[model samples]
Target: MVLVTGIVYKQVKEQTCGISFHRDTLYDPIVISRIRPDGLFASSSLAVGMQVLTVNNVPVDDMTSSEALQLIKDTVGQVSIVAENRTIAVAEAVCVNAAPLVPESRQKRGFIILKQVEKSYSFHGPMTHDMVNLINNNLRQLKLVHGANMLQFSLNSSGHFYGATNNAAQRVHEEDFIVIILETMELLGWCLKVQYDRSPGGWQKELFVFHRMSE
Candidate 1:
């Protein structure tokens, strides 16, 4: 569970919170389904897919969507919320034989962590297209594409944008972070901050944090 705190300010005199929620059923937790890039909740740590657990110290795990909405509406200025950061794990076998083979074992596993940020993505790489294709293909096999039309990845080394391409000499050592950008019709743009790592046994695992990007 994660604690997210932010002020709920009115934008353009509209009472809308600039955030939307969804509940599959009364038994299910309320999940953040959509968020505006410039909305009140956008500046906070909240992100899509996070399950809303409590609103202003009131637990809404078992409440209906209307009940949860009321709790949020009752707030005057600052709002405090507790949510769950759900992680999706992809098994190693899913991409054992993926293309652009490396010398090490191809066995790998990963987790997707959804979160939000803002950035531009016009950097060019000699092999950027190939890298994007490889990652998207893996995402498709995991059934996590979710309508994302394009994906671009680059290495973030000490705050600088470094393209993660298919060059044989280029290496992503342990503790390196990769910035992944996803574009779609619905959400427009999203960013995935990935930390690449390798286990002592040579197994690879990537931790992906998803973020909503502003234009």
Candidate 2:
């Protein structure tokens, strides 16, 4: 799962290759979040979602994002990078299940069913107004919204809600599960869960779940 690539860039002009990195915690491996289209790594085998293992022959498995960036910045001439491809790791954790047909009445009641797939993630929770708004906003930003029933979204390795889309007809209710089909293997990170209290002086509680799908 380890991949090696070389990137040559002017150190004087570019402090670090046009790549953004993210890590969930200090012990977590630094993951490539985004790559600039004009950057040196764009044309290389390096890609987003890959974990950084070393930079310029220096081991970075235990380094923070800042430390890794600094190492890359101090390198001269051509910089060699070693990364770990997590596709296989993600594939091992995926569980296959049969697809279910959701009726219109069930959809209105916050029931959602996705197409059958070899790789997919299912999330169970109570869908609230705030959750709906968040999903709609993210989907709109990613431009994945097409109609009332179609929805698509993606999360980074750190479990950050990056993209999502869902129409008004489909609502999420308590104990309802939403299944998402994965186009590519991805490391499932912690996802945010929200629950609202319906009693007097109601309050909302937030929870985090690992290896779960986001709203």
Candidate 3:
């Protein structure tokens, strides 16, 4: 709803709170977003489904999403937020990718990271373990050496992953594509670490955390 309501939300430019949000219309103009454990959001104690009522103490009830987001972006240093009956302290991240890369063509050397600011994606598909394992196997055999590469994938209408590498030297492999894409992203600082967890139809959920690479 934040996107449709014409709210001026902050897209992470230099630093971020490690969150992705959507407006909740059922109550006062509150935002619904995930606060990761990376210590970037209002508090480490914040959980999913809690409504964000304010940012830096500005009333969000009358503001659009963009306005609220911009307010958060404008405030720097220590940020205090009141929500769900307690106040939380959020400190802006001090570190950046010191070796930030410049955008260039695939044939050129570059850097890549997967899954950007948001942590997860929700899609409806019968994606199976066999399919996932195949991708991993493919990634282990990749030979691209020119540019930095990251995973760029989306769920098509037919419930299949249409995947690609953003800046690799060679074209995407048709088989085991997901593994190849994710492995390339791992070459960068960003990648998925699949773990064992129970989900519907014998599929495991993916967990991602954001961190800056050590130089």
lDDT of each: 0.42, 0.43, 0.38
Off by over 4 Å in 2: 11-16, 88-215
Question: What residue pairs are clashing in model 2?
Answer: 110-171, 139-164
Question: Candidate 3 has which clashing residue pairs, if any?
Answer: 7-65, 7-66, 8-66, 8-67, 9-66, 110-148, 135-179
lDDT of 1 by residue, 1-215 (tens): 45555556543321446555555456566766545554568788876667788887788878865567656655666566677766422221011111233222332223224221222222222222443445445433321122322223444554322333221111211101121122111122223333222233543323334333332
**Runs in model 3 with CA error above 4 Å?**
1-13, 85-159, 163-215
Consecutive 10-residue window with the lowest summed lDDT within model 1:
168-177
Better of 2 and 3 by TM-score: 2
Best by lDDT: 2
* Winning model by TM-score: 2
Could you tell me how far off, in angstroms, the CA of residue 64 lies in candidate 1 after the best superposition?
0.9
Candidate 1 vs candidate 3, lDDT winner: 1
- Candidate 2 lDDT tens digits, 133-153: 444443333212134333433
Off by over 4 Å in 1: 1-3, 6-14, 88-215
Q: In candidate 3, what are the lDDT values of residues 1-215, reduced to their tens digit?
A: 22111122234422445443334233443443344344265344444444466666666777654456556555555544434522211111111232323122221222222222222332223333343344445554554435635333456586655444443321222212323343333333332322122244643233333232454
Error of 3 at 152 (Å): 7.6
Q: Is 2 or 3 the stronger prediction by lDDT? A: 2
